[model samples]
Target: MTTLFKAPAKDKAALEEGAALSPRFDGSGLVTAVVADSHDNEILMLAHMNEEALRLTIETGIAHYWSRSRNSLWKKGETSGNLQMVDEIRFDCDQDAVLLKVRVGGADATCHTGRRSCFYRKVVTDGGQTRLEIDAEPRFDPTTVYTDH
Candidate 1:
């Protein structure tokens, strides 16, 4: 059977170098992207995974990310229980970014405002005036979605 985690031929050298030089959380500047997924192609969410997050994701099969805004580590669905179950991870040819296809579990949406995804809204210009409109309703209310523990 074919393995999903096999290193690409092109990335083999870099992976080896990274493993040797910066093995553990040294941020080797390799692995520029992470594409997580469940069985299907539904994208639960998309986030940048740094070296630490990448290692953790590979080790645990859970989505971990580097929060640019929070400037810290973030495990997906930690607070909302809308966990992203990673089925597979893939990289682009250039290894610049990742496409995360994941299974979104629980009631919470991927969007911060509690929408199904951050792409829930579509921008349009009316009479040459740009206006933001509600293209889609929130999949679930975050307040009720997450119970206090």
Candidate 2:
């Protein structure tokens, strides 16, 4: 697919200060996308965007991501009905990463596990034994929501 953005400028000053949306995709042709809830500024998930995914998200006002495991472009919450309606998008100075402020629809969940956010655990160290503990409750039942699972 043709890219909507030009190749990122090589000049450090231009890349950092210029008013452009030229994303500096990594070697894998992807940029990191950090998604957050627009309402409370809660981070929902961390995903990646290929050129196509980024274009689609910008054009559609919805979240789109490149699923590394699936190796395909994915529309966020397509099956789970928890679509992220993007309110704002911001990029870092170098444009290697993006921050998406979105409002979730439907069950207000963003995780395949039916949680509001993908980060539902907190790491703790008990006597040098590190473990992850659940920090959030599931907003919906995955078994009832995801038919293919």
Candidate 3:
């Protein structure tokens, strides 16, 4: 892809409030991406994006992330039909991270485990031990949806 966004520069004003989309990637050539529901602003998932993923998302107005586990680029909901359509993209103070407000398409789910959001579990302490509590129910069935897990 052509260079649509410039690399982060030294100008404070430009870095903070500039028209140029200068994203500061980490040493791994990644920038943290936080996805949220556009209607309710509820956080869906946290992922990372390489330059190629970032470019596709911007060009297509869809959510694309670099799958660290898979070590490749993937469009969210491609397999499960839970595609996230970009409504807006915001950057952190230093531009090291991004927040994507999206309108979920298809099943309206974000997690591969068949939940509306990846953050379906809540951390809890019980009997002096930390555990996860199921805060949300599964919106779909992973068994029928994903084959590889």
Total clashing residue pairs per candidate? 2, 0, 0
**Candidate 2 residues 1-149, lDDT tens each?**
66689789999998999987799999999999999999899999999999999999999999999999989999998988999999999999999999999999999999889889999999999998999999899999999888887
Best by TM-score: 2
Overall local distance difference test of candidate 1: 0.61
The runs of at least 3 residues in candidate 3 whose Cα sits more than 4 Å from the true structure, single-residue gaps closed, are: none
Per residue, candidate 1 scores C-alpha lDDT tens digits across 1-149 of 22224333355557544432232222533344444345555444556666667777767877788887777878988888777767666655434456556777776467666876666556789898997667768877777755662
The pairs that clash in candidate 1 are 36-101, 37-101
Superior by TM-score: candidate 1 or candidate 3: 3
Looking at candidate 1, what is the lDDT of residue 1?
A: 25
Q: List the residue pairs that clash in candidate 2.
A: none
User: Regarding TM-score, does 2 or 3 come out ahead?
Assistant: 2
Indicate whether candidate 1 or candidate 2 has the larger lDDT.
2
TM-score of 3: 0.93
> Which candidate ranks first by lDDT, i.e. highest?
2
Each candidate structure's TM-score, on Cα atoms with residue i matched to residue i, is: 0.67, 0.95, 0.93
CA lDDT scores, all candidates in order? 0.61, 0.93, 0.91
Q: Which 10 successive residues of model 3 have the least lDDT summed?
A: 1-10
Q: In model 3, state the lDDT of residue 50.
A: 92
lDDT score of residue 144 within candidate 2: 88
Q: State the displacement of the C-alpha of residue 136, model 2, in Å, after optimal TM-score superposition.
A: 0.9
